[model samples]
Target: MTPYDAAHSQGSNVLTDGFGRTVTYLRVSVTDRCDLRCVYCMSEHMTFLPKAEVLTLEELDRIASAFVGLGVKKLRITGGEPLVRKNVMGFIEGLSRHLRSGALQELTLTTNGTQLEQFARPLAEAGVRRINVSLDTLKPELFRRLTRGGEIARVLAGIDAAQAAGLKVKINAVALKDDNAAELPELIRWAHGRGLAVTLIETMPMGEIDADRTDQYLSLSALRAELESFWTLRELPLTTGGPARYVEVAETGGQLGFITPLSHNFCEACNRVRLTCTGTLHTCLGREDAADLRAVLRGGGSASDLVDAIRMAVDTKPKGHDFHIERTLPPAVARHMSTTGG
Candidate 1:
């Protein structure tokens, strides 16, 4: 048995936060560099971290294995665009052993879909069953304006490639008042027609961008009320181990999800934590509390030490986040979502 398996054999290592919530999901950011600079996610001229500051691929594997051994059932690889990271596929393949051994129940990712065409087949072969692609708008010009030169055609092509590779594709659209509000219904229809699950997310208060986030914030509750005019949405009792709340649209016979971080607080059952590429562990997305695991890794800390650090971080997990958007105030968290892992 592997060292990870041996760690899992001890029942005392399971991670349970102070609120009695079990942490079974972990989002690991491989890199804070992306090919496209979405207005909300990052500044057009982003200053990325140095290569030495980020953990090595081997270190990433070691940290993630420690989490799996501590009872993390689902692992989602995220990034400023994870596909842009060199040798990321090899890292993902390395993690697939946990899935094969039943130590991890699910392994997946969230991407901008720009590189899906090149990596889709390899991802499926690496044991990824589903992936969430961030596509804000379908209009070519609007898409370019939103992403600062991202090609919608390329993203669409990548989506097609992912579906062809037998990976279940889900579209994640960050609902913006001025950007894609009108086009969302059409986007939903198109996605549902293609048998893809679409999730509408309220624009979050994260990072300092060129655009005013207060102006960009579109409440999912308001958007849902607007959709009710043309379509009947019935709330479904489904939890994907994420913050999204699902609903079934009667007209399209498709599933739609809403992630309302501002309009609604979906934090009572928070079971996930984010690990940045730099090895910072964020117990809550909207809060600033974090634990650095890179220090332990580089300081020659043992695997048991890594596990103890993770448990201590989980012990300090907050009940919820404090995310609010106002023109008068700064972002809830000073760090960018890219730095925090999507």
Candidate 2:
């Protein structure tokens, strides 16, 4: 039987997976469409999910509530670009109500920061705690080239707006070996100068990237060695629930994070799962194992049915992701990151 605390028997729901890790974070992708088509994230011939197939705001809320009941505390709203969805601010407002009602501990979002100029203040007022913005390059030309026509100035404006709204901002940059490896120092200086933290991620072997995966993949250890050559890196605490290891950079007074999915895997402490825009529950990012919640939800299933589905998924959770083992191999994940809520 799946591990479960007797309902309200202990005054809280504790849902533990097969690995004995308690899940607290849930990532929900609101839309599969994005404004910027970064070369690493999507292919040129990608076809997004139809509007009719995407989950409605009401349906999303119901799903979130059920997860909360199953012991999910922190909720992150993601997307190809979450802010690109229509009336998404209203949906955030509704989720904020849930936070106020004590159904959720924290509400956060991950965006491209292009729409933050208009949505930042509203998001703050709606009870969002923080946001992670995808910014692969600092140079205007490089940013445009990387995102297939994104303006770095506009993203900077959006970041400024988010800061003004009192929203904690973090810059998530994917380190491409030949592309942005040398620019790491500059990116760190730029982010820390503005009181924002920057996280460097290794390029995952998912989707059709612009460059060769093996050639483009840069290990965090290698990046750290380069950073240490210039500045001293002091280890810091891991307060956040994510996989990124934290470090404080000397001289610059900035914090740097490395998400070494390929170098030093953090799957032994994995405590999160993903919900796709179409209501598919992905138990693991590196594996294609998923539970189709859309079928249950659309088939006139009750909240109890949804709970059962979640319980079964947790029971059968894989040992861990095989990203490290499949480094040089073909992509094991059939679905693109956009569809998987990355």
Candidate 3:
């Protein structure tokens, strides 16, 4: 039976298909407009996607519903900053109702954390309980300098508001060598006190920062050794077959995660697929291949048909990302994290 036809019974839920692979998670980018001009993501003079081409709420709702119907249990709404989009909470409310029907189990959102304060309470009420906030530094001057126009205080305040609103908050810190690697110890301590999880990710080799082999660009393997002094970190378990190598701070109630895409590719365990803000289905984040979902949607295909297409795309997911950065390997189509869904 086709992956779609097998969806009715959990006993028959298959990760593998005709292509022999399983599918599960989906990441949706809500918008391409970001408040912070993070040096890595863009230039001070970067131009964003035209508002006309961006997907409307109705379009997003339709595509998201189709994914859930295909047995996608986890959904993460990403963006230039998902909250910057108009009526985003309404979209979340609509998604929550879908989850209530068993097509979904978790609905999460990722943001830069600058606009969280005003949004936290209302967003929590709208049924968003999990939040991943990107925070590169704790130092004001450095934070502003790195994030360009971001206010560290505002981001921190947003974190507080979200925590107060009872959202499960996690801070994402993308580190480079001389930049904020030194602040990892302090950041981890702060997160533990507030019961928040912290994930330190390596900067993908792209954008202006891609060049300049400065001391700022450190690897994930190195981050572990750097933190050994402060806390006795022990490996924890995964959630829903997650691929991150997690470690808990034994003394504190906090945890740390490492997404070492470059050093250690998790291609074998990659069950996720990406959809750009415009509606292209990306089978691999580091692969040039993508199936055009917009064409199918605009062609007046039914939602069930869309789900079947997703299953086919998922089954054919590449064995692993090419780390296509090295000159020896062919490059994936040049869509960076900022342009694609972060």
Best by lDDT: 1
At residue 320, what lDDT does model 2 achieve? 84
Candidate 3 structure lDDT: 0.75
My TM-score estimates for the predictions, one after another, are 0.97, 0.94, 0.89
lDDT of 2 by residue, 1-342 (tens): 112221322223666789898988889999999998888888856799988899987777677767877778888999999999998887778777657768678999999999999999999999997999999888899899888889988899999999999999999999988889889889889899999999999887666555557877788898899888879999998657788899998877888899987898878888888999899998778888889888888999866787888888877888788784244567656577888887
CA displacement after TM-score superposition, residue 230 of candidate 3 (Å) = 4.3
Model 3 C-alpha lDDT per residue in residues 56-158, reported as the tens digit of each score: 7777777776666566778889887888888888777787775667667788888988888998988788778888999877889999988786789999899
**Superposed Cα deviation of residue 44, candidate 1 (Å):** 0.9
- What does the lDDT read for residue 120 in candidate 3? 92
| Model 2 Cα shift for residue 140 (angstroms) | 0.6
TM-score preference between candidates 2 and 3, better one:
2
lDDT score, candidate 1, position 206:
88
Query: Candidate 3: where are CA atoms >4 Å away?
Result: 1-19, 207-215, 240-242, 324-333
Ordered by lDDT, highest first, the candidates read 1, 2, 3
